[model samples]
Target: MVEQTIIGIDVSRDWLDGFCLPEKQRFRFQNSPDGYARLLEILQGMPDDLKVGFEATGGQEWALWRILISMGINTVQLPPAQIKAFALSMGKRARTDQIDAELIARFMAFRPEAGRALPDEKLQRLRALTVRRAQMVDARKRLSAQISACRKQGVSAELEDMDSILKAFIETQISELEQRIEGVIAQATELSAKAELLRSILGIGPVSVAILLAEMPELGRMTATEAAAMPGLAPMAHDSGAMHGKRVISGGRRSLRHVLFQAGLAAACHNPVLKAVARRMKERGKPHKLVIVAIARRLITIANAVIKTGLPWRISSAA
Candidate 1:
């Protein structure tokens, strides 16, 4: 039997620090095209079951990750939160690039299933658009708040004019991004079908569907419970011995969870099936937040079922 080889990398804007386990090799290289070539040469010589792991350092690691994947290297993009928790567990206090690389490698070795493989190129592009659109939307929201504050303070006309112009530009950019997202989905038959199915669900708008498709690509393939859990809608239990503590949810894709919460609020008010679910929970004296969480879980389950069956949501089927 062949043992698996794990290589963890700490990526920064200007350098790539790496540590290989079992062999305990440490290396550093410039984060550039030539550096990628050199790194590929070394990786190509490693064992067949080589697993390269790295933290998702904003977008700094993307170029190297893409290159490694293109060269047929098995790469995994890990969440920084998980790595930090692992560091805490190990009582590691000091921090350095080399130390981080070793920690990532060891974490991969400890939990081989941690992190995610790269999504396809089209999904990647869609995700990028959605993320950028979200950023711009947030900026517009903050600016609107500031504009309101300025109006209350009786700010200058010139400042108000500038705010209006900037706000218009941000809205235009958001619209363009939405168009690009739509184009990306429409260009692929599978994505189009999935989008259609997702849209058939009550209260799931275009943005929600795009986010689900982009962020949670495993929608159709996962179980209903798995689908709920992916967005952090599934309740987690805190129990010991004969005592059961309150069930709460934590950890999953945070962005998807936020979108689902918004979708849940909409569904609770407008979606017939989910509205009934929310009513029942509310009547049972469940808190407003808990009711929303329940609706969100139900929404995801319905979505998973709709996608899995390749059928549009019908009252009978969804109920």
Candidate 2:
């Protein structure tokens, strides 16, 4: 592969700033198709191929990414936190839009693989919807807390009425979102089929399936342990040299972790395999809740296996 020009894109709501090296070409555009066309026109003259990189800013960056990807231009989407950390380590006196763009460009130039670009329009849409739903769910929780406190303290009638209204509204909105999520899944043949496969496994359901489709489309793409680690459920050693300690899990996708914990709860109640695991753990004197978490992790392992091998779950009563 010929070495190409490295370009960093600083993206915002209505405009984007691009910086390139060697010739030091910099330009600002309207962040529209017309603007993207202009930017591409400038990039077409590079000596080698073109490598474009940018940081993730939720859905704000999605349009530009889609546009670039469709144009057959190689694009790299860096995690925002990773880029921010890179900036901190650079030891720059002060930061500007240009500085951040330069950092992204530098990272892309050195560690080209740090920029991972997934070419999935449907998956991208699902991810956006699922992430937004998570945010809404969190907001609903906060609002519910406020309403609960108002009722507990026997606040004014008007306050109670407002709280009730808000709670109802949030619930309605959540229901609508849930229905739309199912619709989105049903519309995508591959995703819908995969989701159905996921649901066939014990402890996995519509919501969990939706999340798995969005956050981890790579379940079957790797080993069970690898997938579990991505969701932050893989067990890790917590020992200190000579000091013996338990294995604990750390640093994974919080949403996936949450879904697994909830699914584990349901699985422990009904999934024969997980129930057996929970029983064995309890026999070993494990804490009740901790055993449930263990069951969740095991369920995750099984789920990964099912997705990978395209096999239905078989609960062996002999076990």
Candidate 3:
């Protein structure tokens, strides 16, 4: 049997700190084209069963990740939270780039299936557009709030004018981003089909479809429970021995979770099947928030079933 060589990297804007297990080798390279070439050269000398892993450091690790995958290297993006938990489990106290690199490598060795592979190029582009759109929307929201406050306080006319101009610019940018996102999805046959299926569900708008396809690409391939869990909508139990604790959710894609909550609000009121589910839960005296969460979970579950079966959401099948 052949052994696997696992390499973990601590990525930053300017540098890549890496540690290799089994060989116990450490290396550092600049985060540049030249650095990528040097790292590729080193990787070429390794075993055929090589696995490279790194924490998702925002956009900093993207270039390196793309280059490595393009070169046929198996790369995975580890969640930062998982790495932190792994560090604590190992009884590690001090923190440094090199130490982090080692911890990531060790974590990879401990759990070989722990990270996410890169989505395809088109999905990547869609993810970028949706993220930018969200940022613009957030900026516009904040600016609008300030503008309202200023009106109440009777702020200077010049300040109000500037605020209005900034708000208009942000809205324009958001519109452009949405157009780009739609274009990206429409151009891809698979994505377009998936979008159509997702949109068949009432209360799931274009924005919701774009986010689900971009952030949770594993949608159709996962079980209904996995679908709910991926967006942190699944209720987690906290029972031990004789003491039962409240069920709560934690740790999933935050962006996906936020959008689902928004979708859930609409689903609870409008989605036929889901609205009934919400009504029953409400009649049972469930909290408003819990009812919404249940609706969100059902929404994703229906989405998963729809996509998996390659059928539009029908009232009979979805239920």
Full-model lDDT, candidate 3: 0.90
- Candidate 2: where are CA atoms >4 Å away? 1-4, 14-38, 84-97, 115-119, 235-248, 282-294, 317-319
Residue-wise C-alpha lDDT for candidate 2, range 222-245, written one tens digit per residue? 886787787778888877889989
Kindly indicate the candidate among 2 and 3 with the higher TM-score. 3
* Superposed model 3: Cα runs more than 4 Å off: 1-3
List the candidates' TM-scores in order: 0.94, 0.81, 0.94
lDDT of 3 by residue, 198-281 (tens): 999987899999999998899999998889888888889999999999999877788888998899999889878888888999
- Clashing pairs for predicted structure model 3, backbone only: none
Error of 2 at 135 (Å): 2.4
Better of 1 and 2 by TM-score: 1
Per-residue alpha-carbon lDDT of candidate 1 for residues 80-183, written as tens digits (9 for 90 to 100): 87898899999998999999999999999889998888988899899889999899999999999999999999999999999999999999999999999999
Cα deviation at 316, candidate 3, in Å, is 3.8
RMSD of 1: 1.9
